[model samples]
Target: MLETYRGTYFHPRTQFITIDKTGKVIESDNILFPLKKGDEISSINPFFEGLASYFDSKEDNDIKFTCVHLESKKKQQHTCDIEFKTFANGQPSLVIIHDFSDHYEYYQEVAQSRNESVINSQILELQNKYLKEKEDFKNTFIANFSHELRNPLTGVTAFCSVLQKTDMSLEQQDYVEVIKSSGDHLKNMIGDILEMSKIEVGKLTIDEELFDFHKLIEMLAFTYTVKAKQKNIEFEVDFDDKIPKYIEGDKTRIKQVFENLLENAFKFTTTGKVTFTIKENQRRARKVNLNISVKDTGIGIPSEKLDIIFNSFTQLDVTQKYSGTGLGLSIVKGLVELMDGKITVESEENVGSIFKMNINFKYPINQENTSLENKLDIEYKNSLSKEKYNILLAEDSELAQMAVLKILSQEGHFYLDIISNGEDVIESVIHNEYDLILMDIRMPGTHGDELTKMIRSLPVQNCKTIPILALTANLYDDDKKRYKKMGMNDIIEKPFDETTLLSKIYKHLK
Candidate 1:
């Protein structure tokens, strides 16, 4: 083959040898290492080494190799398929080299063109990913917004309706209470959402002031006691005397924290005891750390998912059957961090959960504050005075009517008449002398806005001027302005606080 091709050859196993077309072996042939020879075996062996290294690094085995030896070097260039054949016993037997240089050169030009196509494909993939995330975010935002708004709106609707429907069954009354409670919970959630947004944007400003922490705990325990009683669960609060009576912090925000923790504890514990323990640690001088804990005997979180509960939109239970925006813990974490505190939780499945948080701040002096009994008495007296005023309430939902009526009744107030639609509201107003009108915006007959405007147009002066407070689910500032323009005395967002409602009434009545 060496004489016919004008090239040198060598036996890989032994010495150099050349063969002719007559099958005569010429031994001691030129090894051809110094000069490049066409169809030389020595020149191609280096190409095999490069191809082996390239192929070994690739994840897939189906590949090709090509080599071009320039004509100036008087050498042959070739592309080849290097295949390792194995015997039946799985040992490599032979390597077959098949040349395909011309084909590889053609395909190499095609691959360069295909590079642009690959770049476009990657861009398209990224675009799709962003679009999917945007859609998901929109959906979550809508759901949260609707839930936050509807909860309070539903409460106002159901409570007003309950008062109108005189013949409610015992179960229906219980349903009314549940609706009110749910509305309250939703309102709190909305507040948390607003606070969370503020925190995320670094706009949540804290009002540092001196307040009684012991009184705060007592208030929390008292509020949760009623809820725990309904669930037939035992609730307890243990405070060490070493704990400061007063603390310098945002009292309202601190109360919110206590309420959230206690609420969470009571929510999960259907039958078992829930407890709050408070301790004062003066780890650093001039600043005392208030260590508080809430322990609940309920369905504890799974170990794996515990860490994620404090993350926004992460539900320890994704089913959402327990009623949450999954923002409760996230808000807690943010607030705790803002206060320069730390929070930790311990839980076991089916046993219970324990949450511990410490707030470090300057201690305020302990002083005599209004007793719980005195506050209740004053509230009761104020509510009793409100009972004399006839309230004309217009709402469409039976559930909302009931919830409001229950709240009013719970406050020991009785003078309120409920109507489901706005159609009869004018005539009702004309017939009865109302001290106040609790109006719902989205009613069946004539919507709240139109009704309020019509009532304002009536020449019957004093009754027309009677305070008309709007009860609505919409929390936008524009909605409040709209209600005011339509002759509403004030606006109360759905899931409004009972205390706030009464305060509005008192302000108008006085």
Candidate 2:
């Protein structure tokens, strides 16, 4: 118990000091260590009682330790490699302390770096998960919204066509034409949006079936040429003589793609010629490339904006003079690419644009690819006008019911019985025989796939064997195949044209 020595033979920078067995600093080169010659050091070295037994005779030690340091009677944390020695009586004699404060600070810095890396990784993982959820939500919202919008628009289209056929003055006819045109445009826009949604979700696919390529071209040409001529423009359709008559492809999608191109062609052109040409590009073992070109002579595209034309929702006309969603060409490119095909365009500022697409098709196993001879010499006539049919419709929407009735009434030869639900459809078929069943895909009790499977399983001969046609607004190609697999003989999309409905009916009936 002494603070007597102040500067008596003690160095100022000395850190190593010696404490005796009684935990008293008997010697200190630095008197600033909070202890003089006889001051107690038990507060800093709390394990001084056990230090004698732990280091009986050890001269060197590598075990590191973290302990407290005393400077001017103030405590601070530090670490060190400690060495100890003992006297002949096995009592602790000396301790050599090595300060390790800098190494401890370095270890703390490394731990902080690891913590930051883990935090960054967690944030990145959460962001990716949120993006995926947002993508899925967008797809679902688009699909469901498109479906809900189709039902009411279908009623409008059907009744508008019905009103068009009535005896009206020229002024009234003009108003009805406006309604029909606007409704048709709206319906097409909805279809394009749904197609884009399907493409985004990777749900759009190609479902190939055997079809007549010539007939398809004829139908598309007639549809677009009529539209072109309505605007006082000349339209021409030509095909190479070497093109095949029967081929295998996704016929519906092919028709959609060409219609999109032709619609854009007619839209951009004013009084020039709109021409469509189909020629052979390549012929391999079973694959063939059909090169389709749509050339127009109206106001054309600029050189710099060619790349942006195919972008979704990108319209070149800044004034918004045209009436389209600008999604047609986008959908066209997507569908063509899905078919393993390519499309290119050439244009001038004030001249016109020529859009060319090369799509591949394969020969069906049912066909003999040996000859290019024309075996299909069939003619398509409007025979449904004179035929009578008993058609049964199973639909849930009231507007859809009225629309369907209006469409059938316009057809003039069908005795149609409308059922509000799946049960009635089954019971009606069980009690009475029907020619065709137009089954809706979404209803209160049951829907298309389930209802069709039910009818197919029924013991009644009429129910089991009747041709059931699916009526749905589902835009995915896989849904059509799913409906077919569920025992549907054909599918007629909602918001259909009168001629299309009648043609489908007659085709399935006869």
Candidate 3:
């Protein structure tokens, strides 16, 4: 390597070049400088610590050069800046030495960019997938909404027409009863809608208690027996008394679950009977597991459609022939799960369907069970109304007004008057005093909010802090809050049951 040095000797290990004003190399040395005589360097290299200063210096001015270094067997790699300059007469002169290694770093940067691009693409794909699923959920909700709304609207329309007919025979009166019964069914279905809304929006609170399991089954059987009889189908409850007598759970909601199931059974069955058989495991200090099976001889579901029947708004072909909101089983499933229970079904086409549900729960001791006691008293008294109370009814629809009036009349002891719109409501309030008002949010001319504000603005002496309840077809939370803020004492979602409406009236009016 030393022999490679000649006049104004140059070595490759050191990148520095000692040069004169004529652009001739006095001395140059570096190991990694691989430059030949005609090779051109474009820019400064990594080893140039003060590259800006080197490019600005008079000794290296008018030059473009990059650093190059070489690996050695023993000595460490040396780094030095290379420079190529022009003489004052414009002739190119060069002296080169080793500089910092480029070492494939540019390729590593390209690979990193590629990986980031792939990751970004995956994130975008996931975002699009989520958006599509959200849209699908929205579509499903709309379908269920239409089904729930249609049932009550259909009843309100049909019953009004039936009640308007004057010339009616005994059979015609029976038809009217059927229409009214269907309307009541619609109201019950709407109550289920409100219950589901409460559950979905986390507004429903569970009230747990202990009650006789056998008594609950017996009551469900007796109630559904009449419904089955109306359909000309027999109803039976097969249970073993050996099971626990008292179970600590929300018996009211549990019974409601089975009642909904049995109702569905009777509604779809026209010819055959519906049987409820209870089987249980009696072990572990009154710890009971009961399977309640309701087998119905009705228009059975197709095997493929059976799975989706419990889904909201889902109905098979046989169900579409009759009247239903298609929310019965949906509500049933929700209530069943709320009790930490499981429900399943089996059906064969035209052969009927069977639903089997299992519940595991504990029984309470030494406390008097009000469920059976209250149920008996409920059956003995006006089952719909437990108290006499004054109620003001405000609504726009004549048909709805008449239906509600008939229902209240059936309850036997409600001091109720119907007002057509909010304008009449104010006039009625000026002269009369009432315990509670059932104000329809949607009226012909006046909106409920304006009416509420007007009611709130009267003189303190004239003002009444009466409970004003809203009855509206809309069941959204925002709608409920809006009415509540506008001085509504509470809100009863539209198309409520005879029993539920009367109960609410009794509660607030009293």
Candidate 4:
């Protein structure tokens, strides 16, 4: 066979040899390894050295091994597969060798590809973990910073409220008003940044509840009317009577949307008017689509920048005159989208800008004879009168405690005890029968949630059922839900005004 195929492509790379039962080569083909007729079969390669012993012990008919032969002069190697076969008597007889370099190279490529894929997968997983950790750190920093900021601003605004009532000259009052307004602005800016962080982390959520749409609009109108008077710009609210008065939606977020739009309108318009209009777009059974627009005859945005105006921290005005953190419109857009709504804008550089939003809400099932209006009126009236009630305030911050005391002092309706730590708070709740408990979320000894749980588990009925309002500087939607689940009746964010603080107190007191 070697003579017939001597010069063919397969002949030079293939070798044949005859071996004895003792694994000694009796006849040889030197095409592959330059072996002689009397050479030992194991002398070809180290791999075959073990193969000869394995075949001798196992009584195998054929054994295959991949072995390498090196050329010392060329400094190169050739890979080959060697098959040793025995005759019918089970005596090892012949060895056939074939070049396996091509197969070996193919397998090496496959192994290298698999190794690269494994490494890439590990790297991707590590990258994802790093990003998640970074995101978590960012969120924690934002929450802590917000808490630090809101605490001090609460003192500023609360003192501003106190100063506004004191006897002062016209100039002094004006100066206090400026300080109050600036403080309020700073508070809103902080709120915007915190809100944007929440949005980025996917923590912001829409909480839907039954609310009076007309009352919400009425409150906005009353508030903005005063703001309009201060800005010397005419403000108008055009309400569509066809829209339902009672609707189900996230009232706070909805109010924020309108407030932000109106705020932007009033901020840019110096010499002209700002108008907020709500019109009914379409009405299905129990579902109403409303078109809301805020138009301002102020310095409008350029057409080029209209697209990016809703981007976070994007400001059209480069001048230092106008004041904002540039997160208002972005927050407004985020809120609108979160409520399953859409908003658009039309603006020119000089004429004016109009922001239009469309949103849907469900009319409450039982709207007739609703007591919302009556309840609000009674709460306001009760807040005004000095009704004797016992109130316990748990606050760790001295400034916050002073602010609350000063604000509550105006009504003089409640006998108030302030506790700064959780141990004292628990003791107070256990011993004292109070109408309301204002629990601070972060305090020494025990956190507010755990303290509330401990109080609820007490034997006293008042301890379990008393109106426990969570006083927190970091009140996110998740925290609100958690507080509610942990037996907090309501939540009052820090830096609260006298009216808000008292209204909540009165509402829960009833």
Candidate 5:
């Protein structure tokens, strides 16, 4: 044991010495400093003076002290800690010295690493906060821009309808038709942009409801038949008769998917026929899988472009021959996947292309077998009454107001009053009786949501129970939810047609 201890470097660096009761060295290692047997302990270093005093007092307690040793030849300094102890008889017996340089360096490295980790954590937190703020600013800008654009567009299309009704020459009518077509095209482009934005931010969601499958197909047929005739091409629809009459799904998004596919077909196929086919692919208890395809003999896509066709802002026609935002196929793919469906495409350049999709829907439980036409007739008959309805329209845009007046004037069953701001709307509601209120969501002085709450709290008899519909151009899903939460009976998006407007008004009034 003694030989092993002497062979190690720590044994020599950490010195041990034996002293007598009078503080005279009796034995020494002689490794740190040379000392004779008769030398006093305090003669080598002043730090030992306190140890000598403790020995003279006959103290038996262990004591520790820090001291620095200077090497004269190398001019280097070493720091150490020393411990002193005595024998059982209360006489000084031994001393120990330990080097502490490496321990001090180790503690310094640990502290530096801790500080760096804290700084990195703080930097990451700030970056995340900055990204969140940027996203919020972008969403707000898009919403405001949509509102500004749709308000004027509503006026343009509505007035175009009114102009077409009057007598005019064939050439003048052709000019009017051109203007209307351009406006419709612009409206579709705006819709595509907004839909893409919603999908990118993960805010879009599917809203399922019961709808007539055959009726929806019929409407699509009527719309595309007109387009095919205009382009001098044949359009055909093949619907399976075995499909159920009523199904549960998002009717609007389903329609949008087909519309995009058909639009693309018609746009590309000018010389050949375009066909739409829908059939039942499979059936289980309460669930049905549908196989839908749009086949067009058009200028088809190249093989290399097929993989990227569904990517956002991707267009195969790099020459800018076609008029579109390139967001149609992307939106279609997003909607299909969100509904838990799959889509595929097959194409050959200059030959043809066929886009196929499969979607599943649930058979509506407890759904009546009555036809849609009959149901509508029943509702219409029940809505007939001897009393005339009074409707108040709260709109700030003069152009929008003019368009609404022209539309409602044709119905002849209601007396309409118009107000421009929130204060006027409140005063009019308190003074007169109104069966329904079409309140614009954004206006001067106050917003529509706040006005709806205030009206609900009023003491007037009709204020609390009257139907209030929000008219908005901000059609984001979150905005729609907010409008409903703020006491609105329903929502009516801007740039709506006469059929849609009248149907909502009748639905709420009834």
Candidate 6:
């Protein structure tokens, strides 16, 4: 191996030298060092004195060190690597000197830049890690905060809906309506804040599809009309027959705009009627202009402060009598602008307010997806009365449970097995053949999301394909997406309307 001739021997500039126990040079390669056979090792280079000192301290192993060697006779310098080896059996030790001047100069020139790059890379990694953690914290905070606020709200609202149906006096039922209304308001406030967050974070997206414009108006009008009638205020809805009933637009967001307008109208007014009007301006090419207006007999907005009202977290009502988060109009504005629409307000203080929005939408050529309620046959529904399905509802709130049970029972086509906790939910599902499962997100012992994933991973035949529906109040927009990703078949918000729940169940089972 020492006599191998395939490669250059000992690199660019290397010298071999032997130093005896007394430190006198016995052998010399004079190429890099020029000490003769009898001269002292330190005579060839000044750095040899330091290398000799280190060699004297260690009895075994070779030690290498870098130093600037000065040849006193020639007055020249070289950066060199000096390796000192101590021999066994009392033989002479060796010192190998290699000049590293070229490589050393190159390393010095680039070291600072390389070190700066390493530091910048470390900083970038930490920043990314911190951002990811912050995002995770935001998600967790939204989920937890929504759960805490909405659970009791759901219970109160659900029971109110159920109690309003009982054989109670007019005043008593009216009181129940108040409770339900308040609960719905609180839920809406939560939704407003969350929706505003979505807007600020740029996650809110519009869903454009063909839906019944008439049905949307009818639903909004019906809700507020009941609210108005409850308060002894007359309510009316007028639809322009010239307007198309089905169009391509974000139906849900459009509904939200009207909902906020109507809610604000109703909240500020103590007497008189709130009229909702819908009409179309004109149609040019594939675009249709929609003019939606909500006129309320409420204490109107001051024209001076109207500009700031649409700003986020801005409210003019300082008396604080009305319950609100002040995010509704901001959300409405964001959604309207997202759909390329504009809103204008007309107001007279203490008299009335009218909010109008004009938006253009793609007039859907195919209006196949009309309202299902419009096409439902009463006779066919009566015929399917005997077609009942078995369902398991896992909810912890007693009020919500009774309300849902009453609603489902009213359908007269469901056999419900209600459980209060997730453990009972899992145990019941393992034993019974249920057509569907209604799982609440918040429950004792196990969360509904965790249980859903668990059941899907379990080695059970029925668990593989059984439809599990989430009936939860903790459903922020992100939660809905997350639930779907976690294998949830479908989701419904808490304080569900009886008809909507029935329709969803019927559709899924069918």
lDDT by candidate, in order shown: 0.68, 0.77, 0.66, 0.84, 0.83, 0.78
User: Model 5, 1-510: lDDT tens per residue?
Assistant: 877776774345677888887788988887666678988877666767766656655546687876555241244445667788876675557877666656755765898999999999999999988987887777667767777888898887877787788799999999989988888888888888788878777789999877898889999999999989889999999999888888888999999999999999998997988999999998888889999999999999999999999998899998999978899999999999989999999999998899999999997654566434334533853676636789999999998888878878877778899999877788899998999899998888789988998999999987878999998887888888888787899887777656567777877885
Better structure of 1 and 5 per lDDT: 5
Q: Which lDDT tens digits does candidate 3 get at residues 80-182?
A: 4455553444333444553444433554478799999999999999999998688556644743574457435634644544364557788877877777766
Q: How accurate is candidate 6 locally (lDDT)?
A: 0.78
Report the number of the highest-TM-score candidate. 4
Alpha carbon deviation, residue 404, candidate 2 (Å): 2.6
> For model 1, how does the per-residue alpha-carbon lDDT over 1-510 read when each residue is reduced to its tens digit?
767555456323212323222222223333222222223332335543444333223232334333433221337554444443223432222334545556777987899889978999999999999986886675447535754576546556455444435677888787877766665666566666755655665556566887777777778778878877888888888888777676678887777777777878777778789998988766466578778899999999999988887887776665677877777788888888888889999999999999999888776443456222224434544554543678888987676677667767755555889999789899998788888899988888998978999988887867568889988765444556688899998887666655666666666773
Top candidate on lDDT is 4
Q: What is the Cα-based lDDT of residue 144 in candidate 2?
A: 86
Ranking of predictions according to TM-score: 4, 5, 2, 6, 3, 1
lDDT of 2: 0.77
Q: How many residue pairs clash in each candidate?
A: 19, 0, 11, 0, 0, 0
- Candidate 4 RMSD computed on C-alpha atoms after optimal superposition onto the true structure: 5.2
Clashing pairs in 6: none
Please write out the lDDT profile of model 6 over residues 225-317, one tens digit for every residue: 788878989888878877777888888888888888888888888988888888889999878898888898898888898788788888788
Give candidate 3's TM-score.
0.58
TM-score of each: 0.48, 0.70, 0.58, 0.78, 0.74, 0.60
Off by over 4 Å in 5: 1-132, 229-238, 270-275, 365-388, 410-414
Candidate 5 displacement at residue 167 in angstroms: 3.8
Candidate that beats the other on lDDT, 4 or 6, i.e. the better one: 4
Model 6 bad stretches (over 4 Å) = 1-143, 165-174, 215-242, 265-285, 291-307, 321-323, 344-356, 366-388, 396-415, 418-427, 443-447, 453-465, 497-503
